[model samples]
Target: MDSLDLEVLTRARAWLDDGHRVMLATVVRTWGSSPRPPGALLALRDDGRAVGSVSGGCIEDDLIYRLQRDGMPESPQHVSYGVGAEDARRFGLPCGGTMELVLEPLRDAAPLDALLARLAAGELVERRLDIASGRSTLAAAHPEQGTAFDGETLTSVFGPRYRLLLIGAGQLSASLARIAQGLDFAVTICDPREEYREEWNIPGTTLTREMPDDVVTAMRPDARMAVVALTHDPKLDDLALMEALRSPAFYVAALGSRRNNAARRERLREFDLNAEQVAALRGPAGLYIGSRTPGEIAVSIAAELVAVKNGVAAERVLKVATAKAALDIAADTLSACATR
Candidate 1:
């Protein structure tokens, strides 16, 4: 269950290695209610076979219909969909949504291979979309690199982002890690306790006996990645959170009760975290579910994690996912995806 972007890139690399011409399309910008967001990617083969998506069926059908027979233009071209009055009517644009795409046929070998290699290593590299000159450059914060693109005029679009992380090895950790794995997170479960560590059997998760703090410090989580402490142990949860707040991990939370979570935060104030960092603690952990069991708690927590990761405010998402039975579906869905 790799991300749609990863799957597209993987297939693109295979095609490139096969010595087949590949046309790449990325949604540079979107407005209103487009089917795909700004970074949506679609690869056009020399023939007609295509994987990945730019739209829900209709837009892809339109794209395939327009470019499949032309067999990918030799020069890079920029195109838009659901724009203006007539095109919007014709395409059935939802609420007047518009999207622009960049179409570049496989021409240069240097950049494509470099990007593929970085992606294979699971690095979050930024590809700057220069609409004016129809050129893009890949930028990564590396030891040998400190570069920026300022010459862009029309618009710039970011490339595919990275995944999420989970710390702790209990059932809730297992369940959340499993679901996050499908969401294209390179999830890892860090639990030093033997009772919990022995039950670590989730697929696509790298389980470690090393303490959570050391492991997180070693990996260095980023804004694209998130950390959720499922252990509820102050020793494990607090130490890992100390490191998580200092890093760029976009989301950080722990499973705990109101009193327990309050205590956890009060203790961390001694570690010199600011009010902002301390305020980031999410608990009554997860959306309030009245969950009396482990699995239900996992769903409530995971749903909150998803909302936070997606940049949706907790208030907006909790309403939809508050049902006890909904948690079961989420837990089961996560189980199915990771196990398979």
Candidate 2:
């Protein structure tokens, strides 16, 4: 689940505690070109206040209007939008897109509180809701399982869907952690240096004083995981990369300039890693965003990470290395012309 949906649940629980009637909406399915995917959440209050989104804007507006005019349903109900071309245009759905949503009125906050607690404990939870009874059940969920609905019950996966391990606890890592958290990534910061570890202070991230290699080994990074080495020290970064590259981690990156990255790749080749493993290393890890500060660099790295996670083609993304090389060539050309 993304942070936006998590916020919906958090705000819904708070609203229920404050004696406000709240209805939770989840996109169960989409036909074509839908703005929100299946399992997207929207929490609507009795007064038409909402926390999340279900569509671009018009569908949400229609939902709010319905709440104001008709009132909340007594039980869970499934609602759909964009059934035809006219309705699609009216609801701002593109290409006649259609989406089905399951809306459940909240009578109590216990289930939500329980689900949130499990998520806080770093567990993936599957929540099943019976449409007729309006009761819900929670269980452990496999990483592969996603939101599913069959006419009667709706099962949705809730919690952080991706994990990020940053092999440094410095300013760059701190900024990246904040951005990753907002993107609903479970972030872990590993640093063996007591000097750096003691100064680390970031909430919603796991901080460890263990060696970077040990942390990576223990994590056993899978396809849904990413490993980034922000520490400039080869002693700390190289070992982690050696282990991460050999694993199934979708992204294994290090922070450095082009020359430094080239040297780092050479150093990794001396280890047990093969040429293929060393080639997987994404050095100067970020898009070509011309970022200079730690915050801007964090944004650039996060953007690249998201693009990779979504399976965007490498040729489609402008990488920092490729862009910087072009810029260097252009600068040399300009300097030569000036001298002439």
Candidate 3:
């Protein structure tokens, strides 16, 4: 879930506690292009007040208008928009776009409280809502499952925030952590080097004085996790990469030049990592953007990480070195043409 949906839950729970009736709206399906994805949340109060978003703006406005005029429905209901071009224009949906939403009136606090507590505890919970019976239940969400809606029931998975484990406590690590936090990742910086660890101070990320490899072992990185080696020291980055590359981390990368990363892979093969496992390492990490500053480097890396996390094809990604070289040649040709 994104931060928007989490904010919706927080706001909805507050309204429920204040004796205000709240309606929870979830985007369960979308056709063509959508401003938000499935599982996007919106919490609407009995009054016109609201939090979160289902569409860009117009959809929320229409929802608020409906609630204000027609009042909250007694049971869960289904609402859709953009069936026609006129409706699409009115709701600000993109041309040919459509959305299906599940609106559930909330009066009970027990389930909400339980769901919030479970999420806070870092547990993945599946929220099941039966449309006909207007009943809801929570269960442990499986690792590979995602939000699903059939004709009868809606299953929304709420889990702990995705995590990014950085095997360094330096300027690049700090920059990357800051950016990753914005993307709603629970970030951790691990460094056994006392000097580096002592000098580090980032607000949201956890700075641990543990061995990088040990930290990776403890994390038990799953598919939702990312492990990045940034320290550049073999003693620190190598073992961590060895563990991470073998694990199920969605993105496992190291900060190094092309030559160094290649050498690192060869070294990892000596440590019993197979050719395929070492091949999984994304070194010279981040897109090729000719980044010189730490912050720029972080942005380039974070962009690539986001692409991989979204399952973008590697072939389509723009590598910095190649891209920069190509652009430089183009600029030179343009300069020659202008001179002539």
Each candidate's number of clashing pairs is 0, 0, 1
What are the lDDT scores of the predictions, listed in order?
A: 0.70, 0.93, 0.88
Model 1 has a clash total of 0
Q: Write the per-residue lDDT of candidate 2 for residues 1-340, one digit (tens) a residue.
A: 9999988999999999998999999999999888889999999999999999988988888889989999999999998899889998898776577899999999798888999999999999999999999999999998889999997999999998899999989999999999999998999999999889999999889999999999999988999999999999999999999999999999999999999999999999999888999999998899999999999999999999999999999999999999999999999999999999
What lDDT tens digits, residue by residue, belong to model 1 across residues 1-340? 1377767877887887887878877776777777776667788777766888887767677777877666678666778787777777777675466877777776555666777677666565666655455566776643222223233422322233444556677777777776666566777778889988897888646788898899889988777777788776788878988888888787777766556777888898999899888887665667765766777777777677777777896556653224434677899999999999
Off by over 4 Å in 2: none
Instruction: Give the per-residue lDDT digits (tens) of candidate 3, residues 185-204.
Output: 88889998888989898885
Model 3 deviation from the true structure expressed as Cα RMSD, one decimal place: 3.4
Q: Which prediction has the highest TM-score against the true structure? A: 2
Which regions of candidate 3 are displaced past 4 Å? 94-97, 198-207, 324-340
Best by lDDT: 2
Name the candidate, 2 or 3, with the larger lDDT value. 2
